[model samples]
Target: MTGDIFSENHEVEYYETNLLGNMTLSMLTDVIIMISQDQATALGVGTQYVIEHGVTWVVAQTDMDITRLPRVHEKVQVQTRGSSYTKYFAYREFWVRDMDGNELVHVGSLWVMMDIQSRKMVKLDEAMVIPYHCDRVRRIQRLNKIPKIHDEHDIMQTEYHVRFTDIDWNSHVNNAKYIGWMVDVLPYDFLASHVPTEVSIKYEDEVTYGDPVLSRGKFINTDNQIQTVHDISVNGSTKSIAEVKWKKLDKKGSK
Candidate 1:
């Protein structure tokens, strides 16, 4: 979906896929962001332009619907549009389609403008608002929902040593990469057996480069399947918190 105000396109890559040769949820999240940045660039209000004025956009939530997974060597078309703007937030939608126009994935996201110095979310400045030129952007009602925490301590836990590549423009670890780790540690057969139908994550805190983080995975049983839930925290420090939910099919220990 492109209006004159925004336009961008992306090509899929082989390394972006998993061992199964299909695009992964984590990679889709990155592609969604790149399209958003490209949209801003077309309008001359890109990240450099926004950052020059001491403000940056941070993704608050993303809801993704997957129809079919694009495989390796298949170059998909990724397009993005600035759907709307609110007081201090902007809503954007993205689509990934095959060359024949068959839709493969749909994504909608909410982003907040923030002050660069304070690192806190802030209202949209007048300059930031004037470019998009929309008085009101449609409100996205079904935002990606974060999983609820029932018992904070009883989750599957592991620790990760942060690497150099984890940081993105926002300066903390890129939110999507954590999801990659979640997929990596799960039983290989489980990943092979169940395709992820839905994923929702909450970014409660930021994990900086070089910070050690502890990741915990948990699950709830319902009607013979398990909803994989994960919470990540910086080791020895309560500084950062994050969570992810994986909708899994098939038995836990079965192939």
Candidate 2:
């Protein structure tokens, strides 16, 4: 709902930053997710509550727009809230800003309830979601969709085994780990020289602990923006897809 917010102040941890001393994309994602979870628990509908109800929350898609990334040792305010919801999807928004209140990042995501036992998507439960106080609309909100990678040649790939810590209480590799794997496959030079302006990612299947997942990515150059398409797979089956657009970082390290 409008103006409803769950906010927190955080000092960027050194371990979460990259070589440039700025928070990595995965860490940024984790920060936002943490706030959302905090909000849920505060409202008495957190992980344990949902698990007891035989369901778990799952993010189906995410769209992030970056203005600037908070650097190591920087203090920032992170806020999140339930924006709106439909019969099957709960839409949420998040923001990160410096102490001066300048926006560093904005993100939107779509989530659904999944039956824990069946691991299948389930319709949203009104009694459970009522705590968020978001409007329920008959029509689904429009979200930026990632295009299908149609026969995009043999792609550069990296395989990593899911570790014990990678799997969350939901018994699946956390979504942020998938994002990290996707970006990690890109060239170091590209990752270092540019910053993402737009990002779109969707989750299709979950990877469990000990599963070897392959992250494949290919760059697409254009006159205006450098773009990349990525897919995470397990045993040759696609589990997630992502597309990212980047702008070159200036000499001062700001886009």
Candidate 3:
């Protein structure tokens, strides 16, 4: 199992695209998680395997950098590898590329195993450790700590009720769903005019079914880039924080 880099091919489906006809950031994250699960299953440590052991993998943080997003019907390849692990954290790296072998996005994530009943982090076992074949070298810098959003800034907020579709087999809202919720709060005009270049998200707590979540966002403009910060909260308690950097695209649709 050592030295294995798992890969999968995908075609951007119509349903996965945004109004701009490009792949949505949330869907991209979903694809990354799907391919990672596929690889884990092949190595005998997937969702089912972990559930049987009363533990499941939970993402603590993720950072993604995008060069371009694929359009609907475009074929892409996703490759992922287990990069390393510590007493409580496991690191993973993912790359998405077009058929021409040009990279579309790069992602790095930190994960932890949690006991189902206790809902607390647990040390990874041999089953989880041996199959990953960790290299102990990071391909991307680890996710940076997202700063808390202060109230002094002009923050826009939206409320969303957790729907059934948002819940995964783990009986909680999927991590990627938070990204989608964050995107929904941005002004449509801004979304249509700019594309995200870098994204960082840190998960602090879990939002379960039937929970009402609030998404708050603030934007900062620099000469070359626009940065946005988002905080997702449940019952006034912050659950996750995310930051995105955007580069304005020319009218010709070039960055």
Candidate 4:
């Protein structure tokens, strides 16, 4: 359940990039998440390892700050570490840095273990978490709360049918895919001319394969940054909420 920092080198794949050849927010988050899973697997605390015990980890929230998105074909080092935990939650950190060690993005995430059979969250067993080496914390971190998208807000909406590829080991839409849904609802010009500086997502429920999701968002231009609020709805219920703050790219495509 506990371990030291882990890292790996990766090339920004062509498929991972946006039109500007920079990695998309969804793929950037996905790569770091994969790094953490690799670390967990190496430490004998991975998804397969934990599932055997009738429980699995689920991401409850993610908060990230981006200095810049890496370009396609660029090699970067990604690192992850288990920071600490409380009775019911664990905090993990991930960061991407260029070959020269310049930090590009920093992320913090909250995870909780759920009983696979019961489909309910469970308490962290003191003994099970020892391998992660995370300190025992009395309190949970207050990650940035994603603002709710209310009925009054005029929203842009996009519908996506959950595909088989979107389901992970948990048999549900992976947390990283929510970013894709959120980003897809934005205007092509906006997405092309701006880069996200911050992203916050909070997952409230699981969405399974074959479900149709209505992703809706409202973009607010305030000061120098454009702030966007989003909600993912399945049926008529909200499953996830997210917020992203973007910095406009100038004429030369530099943020």
Query: Using lDDT as the measure, which candidate wins?
Result: 4
What lDDT would candidate 4 get against the real structure? 0.87
Residue range 1-255, candidate 3, lDDT tens digits: 134789989999999987777899889989999999999999988889888999988988999989988888989999998878767778888999998889999998998899999999998775676777774443434577776676646888899999999998778998889999997899988888788889999998999998999999988655776889999999889999999998776863443
Higher-ranked by lDDT: 1 or 4: 4
Question: Candidates' lDDT values, in order?
Answer: 0.68, 0.86, 0.86, 0.87
Candidate 4 lDDT at 106 equals 92
lDDT of 2 by residue, 144-219 (tens): 8886666668577899989999987667788899889999988887778888878889988888887889998887
The estimated TM-scores of all candidates read: 0.83, 0.95, 0.94, 0.95
Candidate no. 4 TM-score: 0.95
Q: Write the per-residue lDDT of candidate 4 for residues 72-117, one digit (tens) a residue.
A: 9999999988888998999898889999999999998999988989
Q: What lDDT does candidate 1 reach at residue 201?
A: 59
Regions of model 2 farther than 4 Å from truth: 1-3, 252-255
Cα displacement (angstroms), candidate 3, residue 62, comes to 0.7
lDDT of 1 by residue, 45-163 (tens): 88899999998887776666677667777877887766667677777777888888788877777778878899899987757555655455445445755665468655666678887
